[model samples]
Target: MMMTGSALTDEAAEAETLVHSTKTDKPRRIAILSYRSTPHVGGQGIYLDYLSRALVERGHDVDIISGPPYPEVDERVKVIEIPSLDLYAQPHNGHFALRPRHFKRGEDLYEYFAHLTGKFAEPLTFGERLKRYFAEQKPQYDVIIDNQTLTPGLLSDALQKTPIIGIIHHPITQDRQLALDAEKSFRKRLLIRRWYGFIAPQIKVACQMPIHITSSGAIKKDIMREFGLKSEQLRVIPLGVAQEDFHPRDDVKREPLQIITTASADVPLKGLIYLLRAVAKLRDDLPDLKLKVIGKLREGATSKELEALSISDMVSFESGLTREELARAFCAASIAVTPSLYEGFGLPCAEAMSCGTPVLTTDGGALPEVVGDAGLVVPKADPEALATALRTFFKQSDELKAELGRRAFERAQLTFNWSRIAPVYETVIEEAIAR
Candidate 1:
C-alpha cells in the first residue's frame, strides 16, 4: 500500500529519532549524483528512484542531483537539477546547428563538439557543471554518493568537500568491448571507441575514490579488475525490488504461450537479437508463441533481425510503462527472459520473480546471482540454448509451471525485498561517513 505524504514524513521522523537515540550522528543527509536519470532510459534511473526512496524510508535525508531527462523521484525525496545541453533530446541534429552564442560557455561548446564527433560527453560535462554548482552554492551533506559519474571534474577541489562513495553498476569497459566485438567494420569500431572515450577518465576517477560499491560479487570483481583497485576498496550491496508494486496478482491470468523481456533493443549488450532468434526458432513448434518486449522497437539491428527472421508479427513492444503496468505485464506472462550479455544486477529478473513469473536468464555477469536457483539459466548469446530452455518449459504441465512461479515469488520475498536491502545500504553509508 502507498503511504500518504504525512504518514511517510511521520514514519521517517520516527525512524530518524530511533537512529539518533542509538548513534552519536544524526540522520545522514545524502546527495546522490547521476549524470542522467530518466527511468525508461536505463536501469541507472530506476536505481536512483528506488534507492533514493528506500533510503528515505530508512530515515535518511536523500537528494538526487541529476541532468536532463530527470528521474521521477519519490515525493519525499528532493531533486536538484543540473541542466545540460540534453543533446539526445533535441528534435533533429541539434548538435550541428549550434549558434555562435552557444560557444560562450566552455561546457556548452564542449558538449556540442563532443556530440558532433560521436562521443558521449554527458558524464564529463555533468561533473563540470556539478563542480561549479558545489562551488557556488556550497551545499551541505554528510556524504556524497556518486552514481557512476566517474569523471575528472568530480575530483575537482570544489566538489571534494565531503566524503564520497561511488556506485559502479558495472564497468563500461565491458560495454565498449561487447559493442566492438559485435561490429565488423573498422570505421564503426573506431566510432564506438570514440563514443566510449569517457571510460578512460572513469577508470582513473574510480581508482582514486576511497570506496566503491557494486550490486553483486561479480560486479565487484569486474570493477576491481577494470579499475585496478584493491578488493577491500569495493563492497557489494544487492538491489531490492518494490514488493508492494511488483507482487504477484492471482487475478491476472497468465498467457500460456507468452514470453516477455525488458531490454533496450538497440544496445548489443542487451542481447535482444539472440532472444528474437530464439523466438523465431520456437514459432514453428509453438505457433501461438508471442514475445512482449518492454522497450522501444527502433529501426535498428533488432528491427532488422525481426524482419529477417519473418517473425515480426509475433512480437510487440512497450515503452514508458509505470511500475504498476510493468508488474501487470510480468504477472500476465507465462515466462520472462533476461538475455543480457552482462548486468551488474538484473532488476527485471527480480521484478519478474516478484510477480510470480518463472524467469529464464543468461549466466551473464550478476544474473545468476539474482536468479539464484529460483529460475532457469542459459549461456549468454546462445540462441540455441535459449530455444531449448523455452521448449522444455513449453513441455511442462500447468501444475509444474504454477509451482515454479510460486517458488520464484517465495525466493523474491526472502531475498529481494527493500525491507531487507535498506539496512545494508545504511551500513554502507555509515561506513563511508566514518571514513
Candidate 2:
C-alpha cells in the first residue's frame, strides 16, 4: 500500500499537529477564576482567554468563572459570568449611588459604601459573589485555577476540598508601592494605601493555597518575598502569546522612525514617563520620529509630562484595538518597546515579538527574561539609557533590523507559544489533582 507524495504529506501534517497539540491522555473538568477580566487589556482577561482556549484544545472542559468585563474565550470554553457593582463604570453621584435594592445584599451595600469612600472594593465584593455562586451552583471540577484573585472567599468550606492552584501575577503589593512612590502628598498616599487594602487578604489567602503559579522566576521571588510562600509551593510557567493573531504582516511596510508600545495605564510601573523623556531627548536626533502609544492619554502625570516635554504633537495614542489591528500596528512599527519598571510576565513584549517586531525593553522584572537575547535591554527608569539604546538601534543597517525581527519572532514561537506552555500548566494541574 504505497501512498502518493501528497497523501504522505497529508499524513505527516496530521502527525505533526498531534505531536504539537496540548491534548492530554485523560480529560479533566477545570475551572478558572478571575475577579475582573477586562477584554484585550492584557491582564486577567488575556490570561483567561489564552489559557482556557489552550485547555479546551488539550481535551479539557474549561469554565471561566469571572466577574464583570468577562473574558472573550473560545467557543468550547464555557464562561460563567459573575456580576459585580462595576462601580468604576458608573457615576458616583448621590443620585446614582446606592438604591434600596442594593441594601438587599450586604456585599452590595459594602461595595457601594466602599467605593463612595474612595476605597477599591471590587476584589472583596467579587470574592463574596464568587463564594455565593459556588455554593449555589456546586459545580464539580478536578482542579481550579485562581488567576491572582487571592481573596479569602476562595478558602470557603465548599471550595476547600478541591485542588485549587492560585496564580499571583506579581504581587499587588508592587502595584501599591509603585502608586505610593509616584505620589508625594501624604493624603494621596494614604488614599492609595486604603485602595490597596485588599493586599492583606490576598497575602493571607496565598499562604493557605496548596500550590501557586506565576509567569516568571522573577515574579516567583517577589511572591515568595511578599506572600511568605516557600519555593516548593510555587511553579514558574511562562505566559503564552497568541501566535495566530500576533504574527508578522508581510504586506505592511515598516515605517522608519515610528516606534510603538503598549502602556494602558500611566502608572509608575509602566515607566511611560521615562519613555516619554527618552522620546523628548531623541526629538532633535530623529526630528521626524513618532511615538505611537496603544493606550489613552488621561489627565495625569503622563499628560503633564507630555505637555512639559512639548512633544504631545509627536505622540499619538490608540486604544481598544482588535487583536489583528494591534498586530498590524506592531508590524508597521520600526521597533516595539516596553519600558515598564516591572512586569510579572511582559506579555506586551512577547506580543510584539510574535508580530516579528524587534523589541527594546528594560531589565524590569521579567522583561529581560522575556526578551532573552532576541532584542535589546536598557536599565529600568533611565531615560538616558533608553535614548542611548534607541540611538544605537536606529544606527543599525536595515539588514540588521530585519535579522533582529527574525530572531524575535523565532524566540516568541519557541518560548511563548500556548501549545507548548499549556502542557506545562496541565502537568501542574495534574500534580495538584493527584495531591
Count of steric clashes across candidates, in order: 0, 0
lDDT of 2 at 331: 96
Each candidate structure's TM-score, on Cα atoms with residue i matched to residue i, is 0.93, 0.93
Question: Which parts of model 2 are misplaced by more than 4 Å?
Answer: 1-23, 93-95
lDDT score for candidate 2 against the true structure: 0.84
RMSD of 2: 7.8
- Candidate lDDT (C-alpha), each: 0.85, 0.84
Best by lDDT: 1
Measured on C-alpha atoms, candidate 1 has an lDDT of 0.85
Query: In model 2, which range of ten residues has the least summed lDDT?
Result: 1-10
Question: Could you tell me how far off, in angstroms, the CA of residue 288 lies in candidate 2 after the best superposition?
Answer: 0.8
- Extract clashing residue pairs from model 1: none
